[model samples]
Target chain A: MAEIAIILLNMASYVLVLVLVALGLVVVFGMMRVINMAHGELFMLGAYTVVWLQAAGAPFWLAVAAAPVVVGAVGLVIEAALIRHIYRRPLDTILATWGLSIALKQAVVLIWGPASHSVAAPMAAAIGVGDVTYPVYRLLLMAVAVAIIAAVFWIFLRTDFGLVARAVIARPDTAAALGIDTRRIYRASFVIGTALAGLAGALVAPLISVDPQMGLGYLIPAFISIMVGGAGPLAGVLVGGGLVGGTNNLATVWLSPVVAQIVVFLLAIVIIRLRPQGLLGGRDGA
Target chain B: MAPRWLAGVVFMALAAFPLLAADYWTGQLTRYLIFGLFAMSLSLVWGRAGILCFGQAMFFGIGGYVMAACTMGLVGGALTSSYLGLAAAVLAAAGFAALLGYFLFLGRGLSGAYLAIVTLAIAYILEQTLKSAYTLGADNGLSGVPPIDLGLFGASVELWQETPRYYLVLAIVAAVYAALDRLLASPFGVVLTAMHGDPRRLAFFGYHVLSLRLIVFVIGAAVAGLAGALFVAVDEFASPTLIGFGLSTEVLIWVALGGKEMLLAAFLGAIAVRLMESTFAELLGDFWILALGLVFMVSVVLLPRGLIATPLGRLTSGRHRDGT
Candidate 1:
């Protein structure tokens, strides 16, 4: 019973982390139709922002708190300077953002000197859930992911800004005709989406060795989660995240990490072939 | 769209290149030529067919591994012939593409970002698989692939010298380029262009859009596979990077910066970027990537047609005589 409980908790935390990582990509891609290939780099920037702040004598939580703000500001600058020009051309945006990813990666390498840095988890305690004691940080991570997702749904379903954002996503021309500032909505949505990615990155920093390429490792899985979940409804985030992240966690336990990744990707391809709109379809909202 | 003489001139310059350059440069140019061939394959599918295949190197890498396996006698000893290896490489890569494309192009199929993301995922999968498959040398990859044995019957004439190998690669590239050009000029090409511009319109005219796309994708994969096979002759090693995300994106940059719309530009673009890398890598160190990335973004945004393509088109094509 303890073994099963432990496995279940691991799977839940892993899936929630997948959800957190994929949420930004889903919102931006679903709402703006922009690929944002540099998204992984945005996540990397978030973790590095924490690294940078802590080195300057900031507390761990304070650095984590500042990650989203710094990353959001950076996203604003990128959206204004680069992304603003190519919203209509998805293909060009893919190439452009991939270019941005390369630039961001190199910039990180230059700043951090290509070495991997490990951020200490603020919590030194563990909570016993049976025979196996789970790290406090891991439990906290699950709670944070759930809370953030709930907040996103609230923003989408209840807030006035969300109503306008959804209007733009549903029909940009109509939204503009209705006197909504669609441009502001796009910019804001992009910023929020990137901020989420940063937050996810900062959260994961304690668990993984923080490196420039670490973002890529998480990036593909996040993409797989989003793909499995479907790109539309908010519910797909959890569904897709569970399927993908659950597969990875369970497979890693049974086989190897590499096999786990291979299986998840192959599963996603089959899913995409069978249902391109995803399992839940593009219904949008909660 | 460019003048036939410009093509002739380019081919002439290629033939004269080995003579003018040093042996080291000659060897370097050979791989660049293979990359150019690879880029042209991308141009055929991406620029013309409107398929942005982000994982093209997977096909190329498959070809490289196939050639390595065949030549290394991993596949029965009698099958170690270079000719057989090249054929196997092309067939293997094309087969994989056809299999992948069938699923990808099924129904309305995945286009734009979805297709790109899926293909990238495949590359990621393949790279990880290769890294773990110990029989294929795991992360170390297979090495010591012999040079192409240009033998007919029992007689063996190994292409070990730089000059001969260079000529052989160039000749093959020229033949492939000519064939692709003719294919593009055919009636099939017209349908392809129509489909690229508007698949629904072409479908309205009763063209089997799915089959046409599959054919183009298969053709592109086959060409990339052939280039990968040729790459073994130059590098004598087959690593997973040949089929991974880095090489895949690098090739995209080559085609994009070279001008995806024009095949000649893509061919030159790979060679140009590689040459720039060799020259600037020492001076710029890791920062060269940042510069390249910046230039690539600027080019994609400001000059959608391509950096090299725009100027080359103006010089060679009468259509752009007015500089529009």
Candidate 2:
């Protein structure tokens, strides 16, 4: 019973990470219909920023706080320079973003020299949970992810930006007629999405190895999460992330890590076949 | 007439490339040809049929493994080299395509984006499966398999080396390209073009949307398998990377860069990217990925129809407009 409880706790934290990663994908792919393949790389950038800042002797909390802003600015520049033109064509964006991912990966390799960064666990957050001995920082990480998800949901539901963004998604020309700056919304949303990915990376950097190709590792599952949840739906991302995360964690416990990963993918396929739009995905976007 | 001669000359040059180029370049070209074939298969489904299959590598890897397994004949040695191995690889790929397509083509007609997501999942799942032991070789992949002997000749052509394998790949590429061109020029190709323009209208005109998708999907898979077989034959190695999403997307980029509508475009794009990669490796070292990204962004926005397609359209239409 104790082992089961510990497993469940670990699974919950993993789901939290999935939710953080999936949130940006939902906003970018769901509303924009633009599958930003570089989204994972942006996450890597965030993690790298934290790592670099920490290396420079900055406090861990300050590094975590500053990472997203730095990453988001980079994302804004990418959108301004390249992503802006491809808005009219979604497939083009996918390909372009994919290229961006490759480029970003290479850039990371150049900057960091291809080795995984040793991001020390925050000393303030370490804790004991009987036999398991959980890290307090991890718990804090979960809280942050939850807070961000809530904040995103609130913004989407209650904010003017969300309403205008939805209007653009529904019909960009119509939104233009209604005096909404569709282009600005697109830029802002993309930046935010990238930032969310970065934030996930910053929080999870301690747990996972921060390497150049680390983005590619996350890219597949994050995509699976997006598809299983329904591309753009927040609730769908939640359910999808939970399903993939929970199952993956449990499966790893029972089977080898390789088998566990395979099973997770298999489960995702089954879910997609059953509900193509994802569990919470509506019929709005393709 | 001059253009036709130029094309012929180019083909001949490519045919005799092993003799002309260094051993390393010959081997590189051989790799490019396999990837080119992979890209061409994607073009059939994505460009011509408008079915954006992000997991084409799934078939490529599947065919490779089937070829490897059969060649080794660990479980079923009798099936190897009995003309059945090649058939089995192609059939297995086609079968897998049909099964996956059945599920994907459910509810509403799948858009390119949705298809990409679904296919991405498929590719990921397959890669993971191959990474696990007992079933696939897991990470390291199955190796030490002997060359495939096609019966009439008792001696197996060792494709592990460079020169002979280059000739073999070029021949297969030519055959594949010719078959693809013929298929595209047929009535079936016309229907696919129509389907791409308007699927609802095509369905109303009595065309079975699902069936057409399945046909193209299966055909594409079969071709991918052929590429896989050739890949294993040449490299004498297989890795889960064959079925990776990155590889599939890379193939898609090649199709986009070359010319989706033109079969030759796939080969051209593959060659261009490979050459650029080698250049980047030599010069830029670590910054090549950045250059590739910039290239992809520029190519998509400026040449939406691809380099060959846009230029060919311009040249052909330019002459006609001037004449009129």
Chain A fold similarity by TM-score, each prediction: 0.96, 0.95
In the range B1-324, model 2's lDDT, one tens digit per residue, is 013343456568788778778999998898888888888898888888888888889999988888878877855856667246567778889899988888788557457776786788778778777776555578898776555454544555445577776887788787887787778878998999999889999999999988998899899999999888777766777788888776887888888888776666666787878888887788986666677777877887777778765665565546522200
Per-candidate TM equals: 0.97, 0.93
What is model 1's DockQ versus the real complex?
0.64
Candidate 1 per-residue C-alpha lDDT over B174-225 given as tens digits, one digit per residue, 9 for 90 to 100? 9999888888889998888898899999999988999999999999999999
Best by DockQ: 2
Q: Write the per-residue lDDT of candidate 2 for residues A1-286, one digit (tens) a residue.
A: 6688678878988898888888987788877778888888998998999999998999988999998899999989998888888777887787788778888888888888888887988864656656566678778887888899999989887898888888887788998998888889988998889889989899999888999878877777887887788775568888888888888988988898777887788778777767777777678546
Interface RMSD of 2: 1.8
Task: List the candidate 2 regions with Cα displacement exceeding 4 Å.
Answer: A124-132, B1-9, B107-109, B134-136, B148-164, B316-324
CAPRI class assigned to model 1? medium
Q: What CAPRI class is candidate 2?
A: medium
